[model samples]
Target: MAVELQKKGNFYMGEAPGMMEMGISNKNLDDDGRAKRTGTLITASAHIITAVIGSGVLSLAWAIAQLGWVAGPSVLIAFSGITYFTSTLLADCYRSPDPVTGKRNYTYMDVVRAHLGGIKIQLCGLAQYVNLVGITIGYTITASISMAAVKRSNCFHTHGHHTKCNVADYPFIIIFASIQIVLSQIPNFHKLSWLSILAAVMSFAYSSIGLGLSVAKVAEGSGDVRTSLTGVLVGVDVTGTEKVWKTFQAIGDIAFAYAYSTVLIEIQDTLKSSPPENKVMKKASFIGVSTTTLFYVLCGCVGYAAFGNNAPGNFLTGFGFYEPFWLIDFANVCIAIHLIGAYQVFCQPVYGFVEKWCNHRWPENGFISTEYAINIPAYGAYNINFFRVVWRTVYVIVTAVVAMIFPFFNDFLGLLGAASFWPLTVYFPIEMYIAQAKIPRFSFTWTWLKILSWACLVVSIVAAAGSVQGLATDVKAYKPFKTQGHE
Candidate 1:
């Protein structure tokens, strides 16, 4: 297998045709392939930053306000520790084989699905897809808010052209979909990587500028909202019951907001342009994941610090658009490009699964044959990578529509993702790895891993619970500004 998928004792469980071809599929993948795709230090570095940064980078101020400064970084550090241990364990399990067959390359569902089984797999798959789609929504929503904030910041609030117009939000969805559709058509990952790096760097610089300005203004007592800003910074000094209550709630909120580590899975395969079949256990497990840890810690802590209490609703857009609306729009347009790439890459698995089903139904249609049923106009039946084209379309449409209605709130999505990530990214991977290691471990090493896994399980519970609590409490509080003619 190229990435990770179902495998019987013999090894091959399934082939993710779409994802496998582009060399990013999680199934039908092996270590050697990953090792081959592994790029220079720069590419690897950018992958980590882009994967972890996402929507969370822009929403740091509001998140930190809920959690306070000291606790925010503390949670990030804790998440890194857990994420490393869990991600490594999962990667190692990927290396481990089926015990009965003694074969290695434990595919994604192949090894662990037995432990959890059919219903669980389907449920997890659904959850994973929702998380994926919802993530887009969260990002899109944050982007929309950032668009508004940036506009108002530059005094575009009164502009006639870019005025607060609410054409059906579906248009945003369709536009983003079109962007992804275009990108998915290109059968390359390297160019995309370069683009990702550019986006990551530009976003980092833009956010830093905004954060610096926000902090400076706050310090000078010219904060956007002086009283609210002070309240967030100093917090309540009152003691006794109220203080204890606030402290615990604050700590919980901080923890929930900061607890995100599984994003590694979401982006790593996208960045791995090499043949995943060749990579050894150590490189993929410890090396890749640990490297990822450093990036996340740096981006998260530095990002939160930079933005302070009034960071932009979208991290990349910063708190506001001090730049001209045209320039900002241009940036969003580029971002739309990036998002399309991401959406298609993400849509790979679902596309692959569908291909598998269709191939089975009509053996007459070869995996890559256009004889099946779908076609692209002028492009012809086989014009584009059929699977990739369809998948991107499906994802872009679904995600865009969802974003239009639901809006992607970064902190909220981050927290929810952390919660659901428990089983897939954390618990299952460690257990599967330990089981594969097979060394009887009452000893320190064995005991520690078991302990770590258990602790991660507990933390996942906490994160999920806290996330729900925060969402229930705060979700309804936000209201979109009225668009033109809506009032």
Candidate 2:
């Protein structure tokens, strides 16, 4: 074939037989040099919700405790807007013109490598995996706690007294991780849409149940000295740097609650794209963030209203005082189910990256003998080889081991948020949007937006610093193999 040359972004491509689309199509595309787009707005919405809400929702009450009432809602709303805008920015950059294929770019790392390039892409990968593994660990810890709580609740309700029921974190972590190992074998993102939908529904169910329980506690006067809206700021120790430090911690939690940008591009790739517009992805981002924000506000505000400064980091942990044990147990079960599905959803990109690397490094492997052909009516055929069986099991084992080592719920949340939030969620999106859009930094309209982005970065840095300090302190006080909130 005759060769043609073209430039897209910072790279040049030559159009010839097996030349232009060499690296881009390595793992993502099949024989036709195209990736399957099989997601609709609904499925995309489910994935977004599944990514955005998890154990983080359970940490919002503790966030409220840190930031007080006025600041709590304010930070939540601010982070919501920031996340939605950044997510849409990510969607916009998902595709770029190709010399031969017309357009390409399927993963978040793809977008980063295209725009930022060099060591920046490596940095993005590091931040991404850190965030992903951190999220999985958090989910594992939360699932174990929820399952253990169910065991304890059953014991209390059935046996009538607090007997020695040793339902610790390790066994439940192993159980949930094993379940995740099976779920992670699903091979592709589009197939996980149904699972994501179920996860999203589960998130809403438990959130509603928790909100209802909080309201009931307040209404029945059984809650511990409930307070009004003003009570959020009242008695808060804003004296000296204590208030500043607490506010930073609150920022970290809020940022962590909204830290779904790590997987936004992968989710966008699942959308059906004839002309490859991001309109559907944008809509999905909006709907998912809006839905989660509503739940975060309801859960955080109500929990704070009920417990005030006494609210534990895990909202369910506060149920130690509430009545009607069945409701709490039911809600915990919902949380566990949601986390199981969320675990698979979030881990898909990581799984893909590792598999792609393996395929690249060892293109021919003797161990891969079995292949299952998957047929999608809209997107044609794909293959599932045996390597999935090996890698996903290992991934689950690593996560389970980590979860057992440090099951401190709120402390890990702070650490992960602080470490990855700014780099992955705030910095990359803003810089890439500015580069792709070519927004003039000197102009009045662009100046303030850039400043706002910088302000977000500054806040994230402060929060990350605070979280690091907090995590170190918690590590020193940590008791290995001990379940959080049990002792």
Using lDDT as the measure, the top candidate is 2
lDDT of 2 by residue, 179-230 (tens): 9888876766767888998999999888888888778766767545544443
Candidate 1 has an lDDT of 0.47
Tens-place lDDT digits, model 1, residues 143-199: 454444434434543555455444333445555556655665544333356665765
Model 1, position 255, has a per-residue lDDT of 36
Model 1: ten consecutive residues of lowest lDDT: 5-14
lDDT, residue 7, model 1: 16
Off-target runs (Cα >4 Å) in candidate 1 are 1-45, 98-107, 110-127, 146-170, 186-195, 211-338, 365-388, 439-447, 469-487
At residue 134, candidate 1 shows an lDDT of 58
How big is the positional error of residue 305 in model 1, measured in Å on the Cα after superposition?
6.6
